[model samples]
Target chain A: DQQVKQNSPSLSVQEGRISILNCDYTNSMFDYFLWYKKYPAEGPTFLISISSIKDKNEDGRFTVFLNKSAKHLSLHIVPSQPGDSAVYFCAADTTMGNQFYFGTGTSLTVIP
Target chain B: EPEVTQTPSHQVTQMGQEVILRCVPISNHLYFYWYRQILGQKVEFLVSFYNNEISEKSEIFDDQFSVERPDGSNFTLKIRSTKLEDSAMYFCASSERPRYASTFRTDTQYFGPGTRLTVL
Candidate 1:
């Protein structure tokens, strides 16, 4: 099931620069979207999320923007640090289904 | 800062062997889930459990796979007969949401450090 997809397999950015990670979903019924960061040998860590009613949601240095009409979403991280290097995954779900669909993660590399 | 925990960070078993991976969800959480990610592949959902019963499962969760909450704290996934293709990382997650509540759009899931299972 390719409901959610992350076209970019890798991203590189200089430290202190803005990093943008993109994700796309094919399902229109999805009402909830989330971004997760994962480190090697560890579970994914929840970053930020956006609801269908809101076009954007921000948490500290992280922000998630959603375009329901385009079935696309993006996560932006500013002042990227070397510690920010990890895999980011985009996920979507239809709320009531209680099941989540995930994208093949994008690995981010922050060069110091 | 309570977090979910899993046992046996890594396990290597022979084919046809029965392997049981264990997880302990955070207290007060009612929903439990299992997901696996093969190397270089997307994370796939396996099953979800609530109220001591399975709420939903995926096609990959065939007859060979089973889940149980034998006690109050522990949730386990038992693979009846391990196959060579079963090598992957298994993650356990839990969410705090009342089953009957409908106003909320979704429940945030907290994941535990995955257990890497290697089947020979």
Candidate 2:
């Protein structure tokens, strides 16, 4: 059973355009959500995250929005850059602490 | 920036052979976790260790799999008998504490460069 799911396997967008990646979770115990970016052959790096209490959080060009009732979350990158092309994984932490559940990940390609 | 580190970026082993992957999580982090990603598959959690004992583990982490914090700085994952399906990239991560974005704390996990294991 997949507790976290990223339905879109791949997405392509023109440079300077908006890039939105979506994720959904079936478990209600998750209280914190995070987005990680990964390059080929490299470990994932923390991007941004939002707490269960917050609806939206932003940093630089990256913003994460969470909808607890919908059990959905999304990462939005405004004016996407070519360097932004990478696989993005959405992960959530259960209240139990430290244990994280990750989605299958969505590959985003920002075309220049 | 203290980042997690893993040794032997890639390991090739025969089926039924034992394979051990090693990691060095960031100093001062108390929570250690292991995750794996099969080619074209999602990253799956294997186990989480805190205070030298497993706090949580997935079903995939069975009797054949074990974790150890052999020393102060080393975390290891050992597969007793490797199976062909065990081939995947193994990642080690560490976190200072639980998720608390509400507090705007930097408790997020840091991942090491994954160790790719190929079981033949």
Candidate 3:
């Protein structure tokens, strides 16, 4: 079963516009969520994360918003740049331990 | 900054043969993990290790699979009699502490340039 899901396979947005990627989870036990970005042939790099205690967290141009009741979370990048084009993955960690479950990933393309 | 590294960026082996994938997690990190992803699929957790012992493992990690931190720096995953279905990209990750965000160096894992194992 897919506990974490990203229904959108691809997204395109104009440069300098806000880009939003969404994720949903079935496991309510998950207490921490994270986002990672990957380029072709390269390992995924750390992006940002949010704890269950908080609804939103921002780092530089990236922001993550969480809605516990909806079991939904999203990552928003303000004034998206061409370099932001990559596959983004959403991951969750249950309260039991540090083990994580990852979504299928969304491919973001910034049209410059 | 220290990052996880995996050897043999790509590996090809005949079905039924044995293969070993190696990883060197960040220095000073105490928690280690292994994950795998088939093309077009989400990354799946395989196992977690701490203090030279396995802390958790998934059903996908079967008897044919074994993990070892033989030395201080190297962590290894061994697959005995590999099957065609075993072909996938394997990644190794590490963390400084047990918490999700706090105590974790990255909160996000530092994935290796994945070891792509192709079983023919």
Model 3, docking class: medium
Q: Please report, as a residue range, the 10-residue window in candidate 1 chain B with the lowest summed lDDT.
A: B98-107
Query: What lDDT, from 0 to 1, does candidate 1 have?
Result: 0.91
DockQ of every predicted complex: 0.62, 0.71, 0.71
**What TM-score would you give candidate 2 relative to the actual structure?**
0.96
> What digit string (tens of lDDT, one per residue) describes model 1 on residues A20-85?
999999988898888989999899888888889999988888999999889999999998999999
Error (Å) of candidate 2 at residue B83 is 0.7
- On the 0 to 100 scale, the lDDT of residue B21 in model 3 is 96
Q: What does candidate 3's lDDT look like per residue over B29-93, in tens digits?
A: 88888999999999899999999989999999999999999999998999999999999999888
How does each model score on TM-score? 0.96, 0.96, 0.96
Residue A67 of model 1, lDDT score = 90
Model 2 off-target regions past 4 Å? B100-104
Candidate 2, chain A: TM-score?
0.98
